[model samples]
Target: MLAPSPLGRVLLHLSNLLVIAFLLLPIAAVTLGALQAEKTLQADTRALLPPEWTLDNFRVILSGGEQRGAIFEQVTYLPDNVKKIRFAFTNSTVIALSVTVLTLAMGALSAWTIARLRYRWTRWLVNASLLARFVPVITLMIPLYVAFRQLGLLNSVVGVIVALTGFLLPYAILILAPYFDQIPKELEDSARIDGCSRFGAFWRVSLPLAAPGLASCGALVFIISWNELLIPLILVNKAEFMTVPVVINSLVGDVHVFFNLMMAICLLALLPSVILVLLLQKFVVAGLQVGGLKG
Candidate 1:
């Protein structure tokens, strides 16, 4: 290949700089906004940096306790039953963890079978699972709500977990199957030759190799379930059962939206997923690339 000219190199650097700037601008704005002293978002004839910064917003929104008529109080106007932000966070954590565990278990088993066993029905189910992912959550909301209510799951954390798992299962299967496919068949065959059952072979040989993929899938599902709003809003109506997104959404209806509190809640919500991604990012990136480019 011909070496780039000086002018071409200059343009390339400028283009790269512009792309970085475009991406960082919104993030910078949000970070600054979150740190601002204003209770509500209002524009002042001031520079990008706020004149004052305070942790009071964080205090009220987070661990700040026992204030009447606050969202954390018995109730304020929100479509959901989340009377308190703390309850919502707890509900979100429980549901998200439950969904992640269930999806990982089911998706890993199903994907392993489809990748290794290679039966006609397994192939069909794999393809069908992918197709199921394309179905919009809206289409199934009414049916799900009715079914969960019939089973006494509505307005409960279990209800949210059950609903989220259905949608997230397909994603786990899709991401994991390719990674399973990448594993060396010889490893499984050797274990089988040593008189290990198929399941045993999978448990001992294949499962270890697929850890990166599982971690990635689990992280994705956790984030998705944590941030979900629509299903939780529709299915749940108990104050203690609201999830984080639903709680933040309720803040919007206030006659004067408390931007500081809202932003603080948002910042807190971002922490768990941020920590997860930071810790497992290498595996996540690798799994995604492999799943996309290979099997």
Candidate 2:
């Protein structure tokens, strides 16, 4: 195909810039908001820049509300959840990591089976997994809530991890199966001929070859689990067990909303996922490209 004309190239560049700006707008708002006091934020509703900036919001959050800086000197109260920010962070980290590990382990096995076995039932299973994605998660919340309550799993990190793992498993399978399918069967056969068992062939040869796909899926799973609100919100009500998203949600009170503090928390919550994606950028891109193509 002929290269685009100069004008067409310019238009494409402009379009790309617009889309990037659209995506970055929220981050900009959050960063700006996080750097200022609530008063400054409210003082100039129309102003793009805050008249003054402060790190007190982060200080208070990081200190677990023990140190009230100049901005919060006169404030009589802070949200309980804001004070427990560390717990939220800990819970979120634990849940996300656990879910990623579990999803990768189980998803790798299932996807490899589905890809290599090519049985009629495996095709049906793939269709079922796809169908699971179509069902709104909200619809399943009630039943899940009831079931977890019966099992005494409510108000626990394990419950949230379980729920998120099941919810995200289908995505892992779908993303990973293509990678496994594209792997040459000869490699596994060679491993088996070298005295490796069927499972040993997978463990030693196929799984290592699917590293890029695993990285991509793990990053996606971690981000999803880290940002998940509904599962934790529905399953866990205790403050100590709450994740970052749940704590962030708690910032909005019935009487007053802590917009500045909330923005600071949002920035903090976004850091892990952003860092993970950046670190795995190459693997993720390569994995996505390979997974999208048919062998």
Candidate 3:
């Protein structure tokens, strides 16, 4: 590769800075909105910054809508879902984790079979997964809702987990199969010779060797499941089972909006996934770079 000329290099740097600002502008606006009072936000849309900032938005939410202080006392018309932030958070966590675990286990087992068996049908299965990936999720929404309702799974976290797992499982198999195909068969052969059955060989040998791929798959699945809105919205009408996205939607109103509180809740909703990605950053990079599973 050749280095750019001086003028070209300057243009590249300027373009990069512009892209960064473009991406970060909404986040900066949200942070600023979360910090200042809603009245101040409304009064000064043209202001670069708020004249006065307050922590009352965070306090009101964290207190479970019980402590609005004298200044915010008139803000008593909170919705039921807004008051149940903690419950919605719990529901989101449980559904995401459950989906991740189920998808990984089933996907790894299927990937191992498809990779090792290498039969004509296995190849067909891989092709089917590719086909499934191209199918629009919204296309399946109505059928899934009716099926779940018939199966007595509606209005439950388990139903959401099952639905998400089914949709996400194909991607998991797609990721893991190529990685598994790359692993030398000698290791599994040695395990079998030592009296390990097929499941034993996979559980003890292949799984550990594919840790990076598994970590990547798990993170992807969990993040998708955590933020899923359509499936949850379709399956659950009860407030008790609402996830963060559904709860957030409930807070929006045509009139008398609370921008600061909304921004604060949005920030809170983003924390878990952000933290999870940061904690598993190394695994994700290693898996994507070396797993050779892009196919």
Q: What is the lDDT of residue 218 in candidate 2?
A: 86
* Per-residue C-alpha lDDT of model 2 across residues 1-295, encoded as one tens digit per residue: 7899999999999999999999999999999989999898777789999888899989999999899999988988877888888999999999999999999999999999999888999888788888886778789899999999999999988888889999888878888998899899999999889999989999999999999789988877887788888889999888899999998777666356468888899999999988887898886666556434221
After superposing candidate 2, which stretches have Cα over 4 Å from the reference? 1-10, 285-295
Alpha-carbon TM-score of each model against the true structure: 0.86, 0.92, 0.91
Model 2 worst lDDT window (10 residues): 286-295
Q: Is candidate 1 or candidate 2 better by lDDT?
A: 2
- In model 3, the runs with Cα more than 4 Å from the true position are 282-295
Q: Name the top lDDT candidate.
A: 2
Candidate 3 lDDT by residue in tens digits, 63-173: 878888644788758777777788898999999999999999999999999999889998898888878877777888899888988988889988888888988888888
Candidate 2 has an lDDT of 0.87
What's model 2's TM-score? 0.92
**What's the best-to-worst order under TM-score?**
2, 3, 1
Model 3 quality (TM-score)? 0.91
Q: What is the C-alpha lDDT of each candidate?
A: 0.76, 0.87, 0.84
Off by more than 4 A, model 1: 1-3, 39-46, 65-83, 287-295
